[model samples]
Target: MMISEVSEKFDIPQDTLRYYERIGLIPHVNRNKSKIRDYTEEDCRWVEFVKCMRSAGLPIEVLIEYVGLFQQGDETVEARKELLIEQRTQLKARMEDMKKTLERLDYKIARYETGIAQTEKILRRPET
Candidate 1:
């Protein structure tokens, strides 16, 4: 598909797609005779993977390294597995921290809700 189609399908900006290709994040995209990017299924998959990893807070540098290793073929299979395992470990730690933060936010919101309910009760009481 064309860049615009890929951008729309992935909900990513066209410029960011270009940047990803330029940075070796998504690998080289094949260009058509018109000099326009023609993304294959594999290209789309890479884009999706990168977007997911980035959203999960994986560092760009780490992803670049992973992609480089991936391009090196079967000889780097063990290396790739190790890289993913390390990234998964770090991601789990971040998820734990985020869960704690979410709990704190929920606590604060519940407190405010309880306070509002109590105020409403008082306001409904008949004035002496």
Candidate 2:
């Protein structure tokens, strides 16, 4: 497929795709006879994977390095596994923290609700 197709399919901007290529986040894409970028299914998969990892808070530099390692073949398998494992651990910890924060927010919301209910009750009482 062409670059535009890739952008539309992945819901990513053209410049971002170019940036990914420029920054070594993805491998060099094949070019058509007209010198246009021709993305393959594998290329699309990589783009989607990179997008998912980035949205999950994985740093771009980390991804760039991961891609570099990934392109180096089987010798870097163990190192790549270690990197993914470490990121997963960190993401899990962050998710736990976010859960705690959500709990705190829920508590505050309930408190506000209780206060409003109490105020409504007092306002409805008979005048002295």
Candidate 3:
């Protein structure tokens, strides 16, 4: 498929896709006879993988390293797994932190609700 199709299909902007290719975030995409990008299935898979990793907050540097390892053939399999494991650990920690923050906000909101109810009750106590 063309670059525009890939961009639309992946819901990513064309410039971002170009940037990803330029930065080695995804492997170099093949160009057609006219020198335009022709995204193959493998290329699209890379795009999807990179997009998912990025959404999960994996750092660009880490991803670049992982992609580099990927290009180095089968000897780096364990190393890639280790990298993914490390990123997953970090993502889990971040999720835990976000969960705690949400709980705190909920607690604060409940307290405010209770306080407002009490105030309303006092105000309705017949003015004296």
Backbone clash tally (model 2): 0
Provide TM-scores for the models. 0.96, 0.94, 0.90
For candidate 2, write residues 32-96 as lDDT tens digits.
89999999989998999999999999999899999999999999999999999999999999999
Per-candidate Cα lDDT values, in order, are 0.96, 0.95, 0.96
Give model 1's clash tally.
0
Minimal lDDT window, size 10, model 2: 2-11
lDDT of 1 by residue, 1-128 (tens): 99999999999999999999999999999999999999999999999999999999999999999999999999999999999999999999999999999999999999999999999999999998
Order by TM-score, highest first: 1, 2, 3
What are the runs in model 3 whose C-alpha is more than 4 Å off?
122-128
lDDT of 3: 0.96
Best by TM-score: 1
Q: Following a full C-alpha superposition, what root-mean-square deviation does model 3 have from the true structure?
A: 1.5
Residues forming the 10-long window of minimal summed lDDT in candidate 1: 55-64
In Å, residue 2's CA in model 3 sits off its true spot by 1.5
Lowest lDDT block of 10, candidate 3: 119-128
Candidate ranking under lDDT, highest first, comes to: 1, 3, 2
Q: Is candidate 1 or candidate 2 better by TM-score?
A: 1
